[model samples]
Target: MATFGKYFLIVWTILFFNFFMETQAPPSCDHGWTRTPNGEACVKMYIRPPKAWHSARRACRDEGGDLVTIFDETKSNFVRDILAVNNTTTAWIGFHVILTEERWHWLDEDGTPNYTNWRYGYPDEDFWDPMVRAEECAIAAWVNGLGAPWINYVCFVTYPYICEKPLPSKCQWNDTVCLNIHETYDGWKCLKGRDGVARIVWPETYPPGSSGPIISGYALPILRSEKRRRDLQ
Candidate 1:
């Protein structure tokens, strides 16, 4: 009896420590976002209804992203769970089939992932009875809170929308201009930022007196005279 009691106490202590540790652990991402249980991407659900698909897309763009772009079943399930939790009947995703082009594509800033999740018999284009210009948007439908399916929605209709964006890597924050160095030398790699991401300075892409290329977060404009000097030479 004594040995059994000691083992039981050890198990109870381990369980208590695990529960306590889990309770104190921070959320997977920043406060505003909910990291997917599968650790795919952070997701957010906007419950304000009556937002047109275009309006929702523009709103997401203003937030530095487009509408949520689900990559696979894991992300789809996570997003559907968000809708169920928020009781959102429908929410826009970053997809549409232009009538003229007639090929489904992602409208997100960085383009779509290869995977797709569609309700069986989806993209019918004639759902809800064919009007002249109906069913140009895609939505996650969880009106029943279970067995959610991706369905086509009218572009003008209003519904809550989901916006998804990739979490910043260790090196993305504080965004120091990669061009601030006086003279970039070969093999000049050094750690920067709190995450200690190694940044290497290379001038291979930045040609002297040429501004045809634009690097993200930096603006280097060459004067017309400089461009003309190269042209003449």
Candidate 2:
């Protein structure tokens, strides 16, 4: 009986230590990124180096992902916060107005913009006149002096690109929301769920008492089955 009690106590101690380590892990990326513990699901990358739109997509694919495709306000704010932290005026994202001239859509290659986070008066496609049909692909970048609206650029032009991989589903919970905290060349910071009464982080700092709706309240669950398929491939 004495030996059994000692072994039980030892097991309990080990379990406690493991739990502590799990919760105390430091924030994974830098200001604009995160590392999910359950393999690739929790990790993501954001880049804005110049490249043609098609080229950017290819680069992401080659690197195991594609240009950034924001699915919710939290994700959008996260990316925006990173930009603000780095004082990045412009960068490229994976969206464009390809169909019917001005009909904007995400460059998903999957034929759907199921998730969208467009700014006011977006998808204007003003840059493309009927004559400019050939230049349909779009890239996003900071338009210095133009505030936070990431203006579309011709894909052929070289710029940085961001890459992302599905993070482990274990790190995510149905009841929790995630927000981007900060970003740097190394990685980014994403906070999960609201901490108590604190409002969700807004990429655009809002003035006090000027509340309307802040977050767009959309969530994109990383498709686990899709990831499984990729892993098998």
Top candidate on TM-score is 1
Model 1 over residues 46-73: C-alpha lDDT tens digits? Answer: 8775588899888877766678877677
Q: For candidate 2, write residues 1-233 as lDDT tens digits.
A: 99798677656744543343222232244344454333232323344455667776787777566667665555666556555666654556767765464555765555666666544566556556655655554443444444345555555776655555544232334323343322222222222444422133233444454332132232222233645433422
The whole-model lDDT of each prediction reads 0.60, 0.48
Stretches of model 1 off by over 4 angstroms after superposition: 1-28, 37-40, 109-113, 127-131, 143-146, 169-233
Over 4 Å off in model 2, which ranges?
1-49, 100-102, 109-121, 137-147, 168-233
Best by lDDT: 1
